[model samples]
Target: MPVIVLEAKDFTSPLFLMRTCAVLSSCTAFSLVASQQSVLEPESNTFRVFCMFTWCFFFILTLLIHILSIIQFHSLIPISWKNLVITVAVLGGLMSFSASVLFPWNVMDRQKVTPRCVAAAVASCLTVLAYASESCVLCIQPHEQRGYMGSTPGLLKILQLWGGCQMIPLIVDVAHGLHGVHAWQLWASGASYSVCVLLSFVTLVVILGDLAGRCLLPFDRFLAGFSLIGVLLYMLATVICFTKILQLRNPGQSSPKIGELFIMETVVSSVTLLAYTVDLAFSIKQLCDRSHM
Candidate 1:
């Protein structure tokens, strides 16, 4: 008798779906924090607003892909086409994040360029080209060819890579926060900065774990729970941070304006984190049920 071996799970499975959600949730949370920073600084600026809009748009589209994937919606583009779209979306997000970093928060002229901007542009373009080649190669290859990353590299690998790219800007922002942590009069601001650092470490660990071929069943249980706790802590810290920012804003500013800003940030962070937490918990529960059987 011959023994048969099963390939690792692919995009169609619950694990992949949950992993995708986890990546997007992390990105969304970071974007919300960035947007809040932009809002709290000086006057409301168009360039900053555009950057936030771009990132938010990317998050929504990726999330819709997750939903359509779960429902097996046939009306959507073919799987390969969907992959290409996602690749483009992720690249766009990368550009948006880079812009947020390279450009000042309040650039009035769109044509303005500096030495730093030039460097940022060059780096962003190179990144896009590299990822584009990878995405095209991944999409053009048949399932068998995609197997190089491992049988189960699946959509999780792609999503995790994208998530890691999106973190570059957030990481920069965190550096700034850390530098100014001592100057912050509000305790919440300092605490939020600490949480951001912790979250950054968590994201780095996740990226390393996936690349190290540790994204598996029992380990995933731990990753999922760890991620949920990190996100929850970040959200708690963010609410406090935003509330402090609002109170510290210009006294002449309308109360409604400040309240609205706080409300918006809270809602975006809460919704994204809640969705991710639910998905991770669900995936863990399923794993438990199967193990008992």
Candidate 2:
């Protein structure tokens, strides 16, 4: 049997950090939406409109989550922590769903198949959902033991839920990229993207196993570091590949489509990735230290 343990003092900083990230995600979505409005051709092509609608929906949901997070901070909400977690999970699910649909829409057009944009869009969705799950489950107090690694069922369940959801799209995205990449680009950008996906998948698997559950304290710490390092590598690889693809598509940087892709990749995507990097560092350190006590 497992028991859930949480501390109010330990939850605040991560909550605030996640809130800031959500705010940035929402803001960048809005800015991209606004920028695309001028060039959107509702009659000939609906790509811009479709993209804007999806981001608008995601922005509103994130805004709602942000409000809920703030209300929780003020203690104005009478809801329990479980309730708050469920609420965030639901909103985050919706946000991820919206992005998933938009990503495919970006490439559904037979004439324009930008695999790089598709991959970046899909990656952004995964990062957003991962951060959401991380923030929601941040209160699980890490315990240190001499013989076995310590973690709650709740933590593993949350990870499994979000990680499984993100995994499917990553596969589809990689396959999509494979069909279109040049030989040199395939060896370069394509290889990196595939490795990124593999690393993310491996990290998720490593953290959810029985060995992870029963490992020594030092082993648990090592796993946490290992998982985050994989994530950082994935981020770097994805960003580099995405940027290169963007440059190759529009060498002069004059296309509106390129502009939209750039903003989404650099601004909106970076917001979630940077915030998650900070949250994960703080979280792993907190877990190890808490267990030591």
Candidate 3:
């Protein structure tokens, strides 16, 4: 048979090359636009600022509440284990504020704010450590303390788990930011925040279920209701965080749409602050009730 050969000119053409390049360029442009939009959208920045401010404000409020709790409910203080838990919780709150402030800068331009990021990372580590230590203390209180039984054990364990879960996102965020892993940090932060929210809801359900089984009195019901409010508020915050994550992932789709997510986040944080306040109030009431007995 006769040999037939194909020339390069038959397959290669200027028009074909041009079209391919155009398509690739379009995709690249779209990706860049999307990335820029995600980071620069007014709504996103606004929400970020709002969350930072809110966390800082609540951080101070929590400190004040803890101080008052210490003063007013001195008799209720657990000398050994509970004191450790309170210390962890207080320290965690302080670190949370520092993290919130440093997070925005870390995300915006980590190189310029490396020192701040490092500080934030240290604070986050301390927060996680404190919470984890508190959890351990609560879990092992029975072995170390004399009056560690009944509802106290159960309550301590539940709170320990709750605190531990809350620390997950903070740890993830800190780890990523400190290493300059922006993409991973954002994803991890979102996951951790979501987990905290889910855990909080689960905690609320468990608390209510336990109360239902043991307490039927009106006062007990009131306490349960107050706790439920706190849970609901926290749940709302989780939803807001979820929305923010989604917007961040799909940037440049629409600014108005993304704005809604930011707004939701702000609203949820506000609600969470209120819920925490109410929870503290209920704690005081419980302390009073115990005193009467």
Candidate 4:
């Protein structure tokens, strides 16, 4: 008789423990929110709702992933399991950040902080930490040992996606004040945000689903071109945003929040622009490397 040694990737390994933690914390945090929902203010519910959505969505996703992994379901699919794992880890971390931070803020950032809110906050924070730990474990491994999405360019794509998501909401908020207020410039900025977010999202999906090479266009070249476009659009948007914000500050604007929102948009757009630019540079280098090969 031969004795079998379980691999680290086995369903009974530490990774499963991580997923189990994620599932439990998500459920606890969600239940706490629901338990006291009637007592919370309506205005606060918006943030709480977002928090609930995050918990419910990610919780289900975590369970499904674990179940699938246990049944060897990933083998039935074409997607690279490690690549999918790391990608999910990264995304879950980002999504859970809102649930952890903003949800707690919604519950506790008030004059009266209840015990239910405290418990929920603690659980949500633990949920975020679990996701973060999962991401870190995958990220800290040797470069050659991981999937493409676990690489530098792929991580940048995640940041770009997150930045884009954050901006779209703020842009809509800022647009509310635009009676004719910086109309064309705002439109230009908004367009940049919308388009970049869409492209970045599509790029990530193609890479994760392993469809990049199957597409009609050359993947690297298309990515390089799109990254260049993202850089330009963000540059335009950032410059306009900052210029308008400066204009607002020096002479004052209609509302402080309008200026505040633009300030946030400007910061995120700048960071996203930098990420895209670096990704573009890397893409160009990759193309050159491929050509040489």
Candidate 5:
């Protein structure tokens, strides 16, 4: 049964449907994995641990959302209910995406893959689709009525920033391991990533928590300013990654798996750059529109 919305309207909203799907799928994933522990190899417990953590965390948080909405609980919360919902949905989707990839990759190589294990992997993927749908509907379909980071571009920027942060650890590796890269170059690369992450993360906290308008500067200009700086720093980080890091990379000599990791990091960096660039453009446009108004 659908949890009745607090409004007069019946249970017809796509958001509600997606919420239900997310909750159920999350529950199914963790439960399925937990029940069949004997089937999986002991060495492959990392996959089980990660999937269980993602599913359980999502399940608990989403269930809390449903309860909060049903009871109209709002006080003491730092962010708006919808903003919190979107944040959870997007983060949950990312975690589920990771779990889906990790779970299947671990299992597919095993000689004796069980039906139950396959079902658990499928359940993990289902959670991803469910959360992704919820994110799209919340961020795209009715974004204007939502919070600052609720719009399509804004929500996508959050994903981009998160993805970039994930890839930034590769820079840490380069900073430590690069043979020809200078010490100052290593320090600059690491500092660039640190500043970009800290700035972006704090900005997101202010915006999604509805604290942007309360700040001294105009939120639009603040966002635009932040994006501009972020683009520059992210670009600097990418340059260090591709130019300096890759110069030391010897793909022909390294194992194929190690080579693949390098390629994947570079691809993520490129995509992250494009995402931030688009955000910078969008932020500028939004600032201009606000000025005209």
Candidate 6:
């Protein structure tokens, strides 16, 4: 006997789907509200108030990181490479920090182009070169006995990658400032910036992974983690800024309203500020740890 089986409905009932969607929507709304309250309930003078403060914090953090790195190199590395790396890191950090201070001001004024863009480009270039040089030095070190140039080699390589990636945005910003470009040109520049920012973030993750996998001195491991957090935060902010610029240029088939863009930028900038603060904490912690040790 051939038994005919009734086929189940090929599709879900519209009513059921609608009910599920409603539930999901409610949950999402609740989650968003909770997140906002948690993130935004701070005092008026909170760190989120000014982007400049965040930038300054990260700048100082980067300086401290470089200083600690210098100290470590002096104590552990041979003298030949020690002075060179320390000099480059210190000078590069100073120049980079100074350029960061100038960036937002340039963004605000919009009419005047500042030499800060050029300085930033130069500083980023120097950082990349310096880190690459450090990596080479690490690779050649007699103490580097483990696989693939050891922990120090891996760390330096990651740093070199991060530094090199950041140089693109710096150069593009300099070019845009020098040429007095239009919004479209600025958006084009953002493409390179986006790529650089993404690469920096990936490098940061790789550094974290490297730290997690390898056994190293407590201070060294902490430094790696600390640097990773700082770089990651910077990259996140950069990605948001670049993405907003891209959206402004090409809003797609459904152009986002001006209100939407403003909200996005506000949200992105706020998150960026918070990340920068956390990065500062990490740097300060590193400095303290090094001092104690």
- Winning model by TM-score: 4
Better of 1 and 2 by TM-score: 1
- Alpha-carbon local distance difference test for all models: 0.44, 0.46, 0.42, 0.77, 0.70, 0.39
TM-score of each: 0.40, 0.38, 0.33, 0.82, 0.75, 0.26
**Cα error of candidate 5 at position 87, Å:** 2.6
Show the colliding residue pairs in model 2. Answer: 144-291, 149-215
lDDT of 5 by residue, 94-162 (tens): 878877876766666565578777887888888889889988877664655666567757676676766
Candidate 1 TM-score, true structure as reference: 0.40
TM-score head-to-head 4 vs 6, winner: 4
Write model 3 residue lDDT over 157-199, tens digit each, in one string.
Answer: 3343334333443434334323222454345445544554564
Residue-wise C-alpha lDDT for candidate 1, range 26-90, written one tens digit per residue: 35434444633332343434335445555455556556655554555624443343333444444
C-alpha lDDT (0 to 100) for residue 174 of candidate 3:
30
lDDT per residue as tens, model 6, 64-181: 4444443443344332233233333333333333333333333323443334433433443343344334334434555533233233333343343334333343334334333222
RMSD of each: 13.7, 12.4, 24.3, 4.0, 4.8, 23.0
Question: Residue 76: error of model 5 in Å?
Answer: 6.7
Better of 1 and 4 by TM-score: 4
**What value does the lDDT take at residue 62 in candidate 6?**
41
Could you tell me the TM-score of candidate 2?
0.38
User: Candidate 5, which segments miss by more than 4 Å at Cα?
Assistant: 1-13, 31-53, 75-78, 110-116, 140-144, 168-193, 243-253, 289-293
Task: Give me the candidate number with maximum lDDT.
Answer: 4
